[model samples]
Target: MNGNRSVPSRAERLRASATLHVFYGGIDLMVGSRFVPHLRSLERSQWYSREALLDLQNRKLRALIRHAVDRVPYYERAFHGIGLSAEDIHSVPDLANVPILTRESVQNHFHDLTSDDWRRRHPVVNATSGSTGVPLKYLFDRDCVAMGWACLFRSWEWDGYRMGDRRALIRGTDFASKGTPLHERIRRHVERNLVLSSHAMGPTQALQYARAISEFRPTYVRGHPSALAAVGKAMLSNALALGGVRAVYTTGEQLTARQRMLIEQAFRCPVRDQYGLNDGGALILQCPASDAGLYHIIPERAIVEILRPDGTPASPGEAGEIVSTDLHNYAMPFIRYRTGDLAVMEDQQCSCGREFPTIRRIEGRIISAVKRRDGTRVTGLVLSDAFEQLVLTRQDCVHQYCIVQNADLSIRVLVVAGRGYDDTVTNDIKQTIWSHVGKGIDVGVERVPEIPASRNGKRRYVVSHAA
Candidate 1:
């Protein structure tokens, strides 16, 4: 496959995707997305120099601004309001006049959110029921999706995945129903991925999941980071060992340094971190290989900027709202979209020799932060990870969880239990939290029938409206 294959048509891609999802994994080339290998090669080219990377970045940024100026209504208003045209957006600094679009704006005005011609055109609408408070609905052109996944594939390859290596996905197991549909299971059987339910994992169940890993003996493990940590926890207890897997790639949650250390210890392999959202516009990643002090963001895919609370450009190494412009999302270009997440930008080249721009720190979703009894706010990413390993701890249970912190300082979890795990696991979680938060905090339990999905049909580990 070419590095820049034209994105497949939406109708054609959607039908095939639907058909594949009914089964465990898709082996059909018509429905197959060659994102992994594409990403691998792209990442391998990190050797590009600063001059080389910047030249490509400027070209792509200019093209992206042009796409927005001509097509997107939001950008049209923004450009006119700022008294600038696409040609005037010659340097990265010129991007400052364009105001940032927040997540609320996107969800509230979804219909009017896109470029003027977007409806007449078709976009690959992608959704995220993130671990944070709200679900995001956004559109991606074929090129953007390809680039995003390509970056991921590169991360995987760098961590030690060969082109034909056997792979396993520990995320999306519950949503796809674990290969039950006959066609879906058959597809997965051919593709070599076993979908295990994260909802069923617990401390004891972690042992069982470990046994399954020993049996599967996959070459590479890919999916949610928190879930991978659960598998590591399971492997820790049971003395279970994997035969062939050499690397683990964790995404979907913030990979804490603590969890990363444990995952590396458990798997005895290099653990790589990738940070991205469903909609186009990011490539904040980290690896055991380098500490370049910034995200090695793919230059040609998106242009990222950090903006302060007052909407001014954030200086290097200063935290601010993440704003992005995807060069290739022409179908519905997102110009100056505020990602809600916060990070510091760095223009320096990575020590690994990749000229990709790096972001120093990514503070995920501060808006969804939950305050603790100590008055210290619990960041969404931090709290989500603290609970993630537990959720995917065992695979023999049915679990739904919520972080219950009331005005009374009483802390407990609202959970729907599986057949064997009820009070025991709940108590364990309570003890774990109390150890961290301190004594005298009332820990209680609310056994709900099920964890309620937010408006966008995805679960949120922490959902509070307060900022």
Candidate 2:
């Protein structure tokens, strides 16, 4: 560490504050948003009691249900079909009476799901990354977008990050594509963000990113775990130092234990993992005061439910599918929306005194399910666990791997070889996969120089064509 590091002057701090205020004020005026207000509310709401939070959710749920019944064709028909009414769903528990909305239903009934008053709400269309092979489009009102930003900013505060803090964003190339709008470029510049592409993160690219980030001196490093791990590996291999980073935040993909270790070691900082879905309106962030694996759900953004296969609620420590309801997005409310992602429930409150509900861990998406020969499906989480075990047991043998399930129920294991990787390691990997997925299913191990990123620049550990 530099003993003579300088601190920002009072004038510099004031200037930064002014710039942040002006930028966000301009944005609010342009979009008629309430981002600042919402952020302030979230800061206070995090400390609310459980009963108070439940009241807030119930109030929001009532409003959302009334709006959906009155305005949305799909929800209106669904409610009426079962002889249900808005009055029936008076609280969070009452949501059980609402039909579960699937991704297929949203895609098939896109128009019907939209609110009749969408134009008045200034609705915007957004889509998921389509990592599962199909992207689902959804609507977001300006307020819903503001709330999303608020939720994100609130969670970031748990890591001691404030607005206008210097941060480096390693994201997909599409995030800052050549065709990006002029305003977005200006926003990135004004926000003091060093944006780097996660696509094609080879040794050269990783080194370049490392050098740029070191020079930039960002306090926060945010990216997908795989991309950050690749950069971290390069940094360690080449003895590159990135000083002044306080915390590394990972999203867009699950953060494996190995990836977290590599990132923390290379950056010399703690790693915080966050999970959110563009379509599901769910925002889950790791609690700074708790263990790394546990996450806190933002109650103001959405209502989250972890349910078993039979639509019953999963108990604490039990794994289940994630179903979410967007409390703010009245433009196109996704009531009881099945997110296709899995997570474990946590019943205990954090020692930090925050009442935000907790999730023990986020399992991978359901779309990454591999079909067995007998028509059974193996989840991505199982495969990920198997790979994690392999990395731990083999030491430096398996650097990176991806599982691709073909249409014929056959599996292809793509491996980026490491120090001790060879025929024996390959066979071991095959057996490991077979142990989870039944035997007699053809599993081929292919050694490759690199596993390419998807179109969205995310390195999916498991891809199932059968899904």
Candidate 3:
């Protein structure tokens, strides 16, 4: 007999594959079964080539349009009014034939926008409480919810997170209630995630949150950029170091370069920014292979288009309004929805093998400027930069702050005071604002319990009423 080892038989290989399926199946059961199909689909879709992905997109687009026209009254009317039919929109470019759906349209025809049959599938209805304007209510079916979570978790996996890996979230949710709710405890157990309340955060609270997160030994930390930066600043000031943190994820607010630097330096991890809307559409996430600020659009979730003021497609690196269409969510079809946000679309492919396209940067939503006494208009980002710079320099004095412009051209600065906060700090902030916005504008600083987030879980740095 030859002294050689024999290769494993087909039976043995089949047994090994069976064991893996069982192992992952058990984990899926623990995490909840709805995500199983969606997660697997996303895993497979990422490997698709550009042409294959677009082909898949076209198929989904056709199905979505057919469903919209057949079931949703609003789309039925929109298509008929434009002398277009579901058969006419066979590709992404054909989508332009259907006019853009504005927020006002959604508000005016809320019922018609939703499919009556989808309610049986457990559709959740909610409203977006944006910082600037009226809230817009929308519907997301059960499958849509699962798909969205799957895409979100896929992004988390880019930073080395697994199904049961521990993570911490600092969002607008009120987690500081007297006691945790039963459902919340169960949710945390199932998801293996913790929530730190952003609404109750201050200097003292930030220290507590930092300590709590340190104890949890979370694999990832996620929250609004400002809130996360504040906690990171607190950690740095107190010489606190959290171990085993794989990455920090920021969303729901515009993340500045300074915020990324602070968060990364304090946490000893990279910061990944995610952009999307609450209407169950437009999910763009930063992939592991992307540069510092680049994000990849989840092709399965939505089709994102950047259009110029002339209603034409913007060139690569040209800033334009972001118009997106949800490829899923047939319950409430949002075709050609105007997101009101601005971004630059990258024409180049990423080093990552994934075919998902990249967004160069997300400049915040379009809003009128705060008119000054000299007929000058100052945008929110410009004035907000003054405080952002302060946080960069004196990390201990200011944690989270906001600037609000009144109708009389007076400005009010709301400060969630941190360590070293005092009259001198207030005066410095006033002087900082005066320097940029010009004098004769009444500027006042007010310390508060917290700078509450808008209803949709966003902490806007500036709210202007003058414009």
Candidate 4:
């Protein structure tokens, strides 16, 4: 151990543990939730046999279906119109009989989707980031929120994280911003969470965040991959590193290969990618037991189905849309809801011995693709790979970028210049993009101070306005 390094005293550690217990205990008591119990159940449930997991899903599904049909007006009417009932959906496969719930449908039937017994569930209203131009408001029960935290904590355990472990959060939610309530500030301090805003991740902000995180010495760092990658780049540029970070957890955005590499190099820790949707009720975490980028689906949290366009289940290795049923959300059930995200189905069991189903890859949102003039389409993953490679090879040339496709199929590359940015770097970016998307399209590279984030403070790498 370095003599200069500061270690927490025994009394400080005991105080931190007691504070965490009181904080979580107060929350559980206020909401009538059993968070710690739920977390413990999940820890054991993750190792259940495949048949046991499926049986658990079936039981949860039956109960949820009965509740939705009896209490939710939207599901009740839809089931009646389709000549179906809760009895028709006894198993996961029987869910095919239910209509696919779309975002537009939810918006139209907002009030109808709420369960009649929602008042008893301690409901909380929430909204999506409206990244698609229209935000959708929804309801979440207190128990459902508690289950979400339990599922997340269980996933974090794959990286050796414990409940009271010190961690840093670098995402859109700015807990340190002005006007934050005193209680919220105290809660953050008691929880030992270092929250850094990702809204404006310029070089200066990135440097500051890097310095703060390094000094904080968190066991793990969690944030959007883009934001973390920016801080990682800053740390590398200034030769700074967070000495004791065991892992980096990335969510909210796709974690590209180059981004993962940069983060791992800067933090000297492995990067774990997590896929989740608060509105959609899907939580997929990277399989720590495998290096193949496979994600394990939490069976107790949501029942995920990878279905083809025809509404049939996709075969293993086939790419399909993700439809999820959040089992714990009774305030407003999302049964067979279309999440609009794509993923590849995997049929193999993980070496970790967890019976939870797996996904080979998360292909991102369905609408995040670029169309070419010749009717060809390039997915966001491909474009991100191209841009990431360009940045990796020409290090310090580009801090951030957004590839926007105009209605006319013209491509505009908006770049936040880095220290080593030059004309050659711009040409390299253009060439990289042209390689993936044919040169027949008009491509322009523009240097900017920063790329704008969405309403939720997520910086999208690809935005297509072409219809």
Candidate 5:
């Protein structure tokens, strides 16, 4: 060391050392887990021709079918009951013979659905948030998690996300700076993220979060659409800015046009919405070059089918139920699983030149089922559409609402009042609900200041205490 050079302070040296440690540690984790290879493979696969993509999907489908029928008890019985063999499912269309796997089926046959060879693949157990109604526990292998993240990260790259870019995550986790788990802290530190709890978001907390975003200068923000929109609304009201955020990514809930507009206006960036099921059977992400409201399916990860109520395929532009087959979850293969969400699938290729299929719109989930005295059940989506239509035509009166079914088959409508709301709007909503739900069911409407979101930051339009 030169005698004339000033020595660095101990604190400065320690800070520099810590920063280097985090940087190297992050690199080690990324490389050691084989995520980089998967990312590269997915990036290349996204550019494959539609025919090529379908070919790859068919190959994976065949392998999954063989594995499922041989090792999974549920699929073994299902295939045999239909007098079909694994070889019978030669293509995507042939999967129709296999019975539709409902959420209830997975819940009831959790043990049977899980592969007997789960231990060999390092299976990890996880549960759904139960936001829709009932939570279901399932298993996934480490490779499934890693490859899914790789596919997701590749899509994020389209919106200018790079490794080590500062990110602000506003989701449904505890954001208290104290008592954070070691793994969570390490993730935040190494990935350069700031996690704000969605549960505690209010006007004051939004302002605080906006300030943090400005200071952090995150490259992007990711979270539930409603939570992000709330922050956006608060920021706009408070005249705050999310400094230099290039994009906003929304997931876990439906991204309405109003919410998208609010989020984009507040953040001064584009909003990219994503749709996925907890079962790892489906993933659809918005393409950067495409406009909002259009999501391209990640064909390499899952085979998605938009089927009619009768289980046949829905025509393009016609809304139908979404059934998906996970291509990678060998530990617990969810073949022909019915995701209760509805969507209108687009047959045409995206203008951006990608070969993946696009979904024109996602009509949220079916939500809770409303049961009647005779044991007949009605899906909550019917009541939800009624409220949606009322709000669409009469936004000035009905801001938001939720339908709750009680034990006695009575319906309680919790409403968030808007400007000029009165008895007329209330009566119309009640009548609409009654019309779809049939006669002899008591319907009541009550106004409230606000309707709180579910723990996972989802605003469930329907809740059933009866179920």
Candidate 6:
């Protein structure tokens, strides 16, 4: 979002939700071609082409309008009240007449978001991981899962990765055990993967992670960016080699330029980023190094759109909301549902002639707002990027810390203390942070073995205590 983009009024936000709920409640979203080769072929067809992307978008859109007009209780009433008919909306070109979806709409009408048949058999339950506030229990079918994996594979391929190539996932999985026992080691050798525990990333634990990666000699390193950043920092101090990792795939949290620089410098590989919220969307992957990535809207599986704050269509240059339609996941075919994120659309033909529509930048969910020392409020918790810039000048000092804003404007800092933990250095960091966020910054420190991570292994730089 632009610095000047005002927050939507309560009523406008509500109305946007109403429109989303009514429209989504009515549509029968469907998808096929779950394999990579099939998907690659489909890219040449009507739905994946630029004309087809727009055409299918409009066609399905008209179908949605018809569904809402005929079946949706709320949408039928709204369409009737507007003096419009399903017949009036001829194509996706006419989608403008219909309202845009919003986060509020999804939350308020959660049950109405899907069809009844979708709730039955083969309903794959998935969640948004709560990175954004409105964490939803979504549904997907087998095809949805396959398409998601296929999209992920495409990201890996962009990074010079091939199928069956050794890929080390530095993430927490149900697979991790207290120790790699005989059976687990056998599995690792067979699968050619070393699963690192996300929760165990302290100094000693990092050594274990490093040893695992070094021994595996994986072709690509993948995990939450924040977790990888911590591992990168650890590798820097310990002089642990990343071995043969030609690429690094990071997802979940926003990848800072500084973090990217550090990870790339440490791993000696292109640190690529993939975007997805598990909100009825597929993984939006890109090789940032190639500059050929536009987060190609997965045509056969998902329909993507950018909506302005007024529930209006956001043109090329504007930063607006991102919404997706999960086509393959009929169990939770989130039709034109709003995802509360700010992203910019780019219509420019990419340097790579893939002809896929792209999103230039997705300014993620802006929810870190908090009261500053001056009584003013800030909405994002990314103030840590301010601290993330701090280099590791000495190996003996605490390198990173997160500020937790409380309801009373006070802040608490969670830190990784160095060997010689003392008040002097701690005071210096506290004072420096206050210098940036402002003076009179009542900050307290809590020294832990290491920073805590979410179940996904992503580190939150700043979190509201209230959250």
TM-score leader: 2
Of candidate 4, the 10-residue stretch with the lowest lDDT total is 1-10
For model 1, how big is the CA root-mean-square deviation?
8.5
Candidate 1, residue 465: lDDT: 45
**CA deviation > 4 Å runs, candidate 6:** 1-33, 42-49, 59-110, 119-121, 128-135, 176-192, 288-300, 307-309, 313-319, 344-349, 369-382, 391-397, 408-411, 419-450, 465-467
lDDT of 1 by residue, 174-291 (tens): 6544437876666566556766666554556567767777787777777665567767877876788765566777776556655677688888776766677655476677643565
lDDT-better candidate, 3 vs 5: 5
Backbone collisions counted per model? 19, 0, 0, 0, 0, 9
Give lDDT per model, in order. Answer: 0.64, 0.84, 0.78, 0.84, 0.78, 0.62
Candidate 1: residue 423 lDDT (0-100) = 67
Regions of model 5 farther than 4 Å from truth: 1-33, 129-132, 175-179, 368-400, 403-412, 418-444, 462-467
Ranking by TM-score: 2, 4, 3, 5, 6, 1
Predicted candidate 2 versus true structure: per-residue lDDT over 1-467, tens digit per residue: 11123565788678766875788877888889988778778888888999999999999999999999999999999999999999999999999999999989988999999999999999889877576567788898878888898788777777766557789999886643566678878878887888888877777888888878878889889999988998898888888887778789999987777888889999988888888876768888887788535788888889999999799999998878999999988888899889888888998887678888999888877768788878777778778777777766775787778899998889999888888777888788889899988897999999888878888788788878874
3 against 6, candidate with superior lDDT: 3
The 10-residue segment of model 3 with minimum total lDDT is 1-10
Write down the worst ten-residue block by lDDT for model 6: 23-32
lDDT of 2 at 249: 93
lDDT of 3 by residue, 248-310 (tens): 999988887678888999889888889977573898888767664578989988888889866
Candidate 5: what lDDT? 0.78
- C-alpha lDDT (0 to 100) for residue 36 of candidate 6: 46
Query: How many collisions between residues are there in candidate 3?
Result: 0
Tens-place lDDT per residue, model 5, 1-467, is 11122454677456644654565445547544445667778989988998899889999999999999999999999889979999999887788888898888889999899898998877778887665457889987777777788788888877655566688998776656445787778878877899888876665777787777777888789998777877787788778766577789998877666677789999998888888865855998888777545789889889999998799999988878889999988889988888877778887677778889999877766446676667766666555655676666764676567788887889999988878688998888878887777768999999998787766557666766775
- Ranked by TM-score, the better of candidates 4 and 6 is 4
What TM-score do all the candidates reach, one by one?
A: 0.71, 0.92, 0.83, 0.91, 0.82, 0.73
The 10-residue segment of model 5 with minimum total lDDT is 1-10
Q: Which stretches of candidate 2 lie over 4 Å from their true place?
A: 1-20, 175-177, 370-378, 392-396, 438-441, 465-467
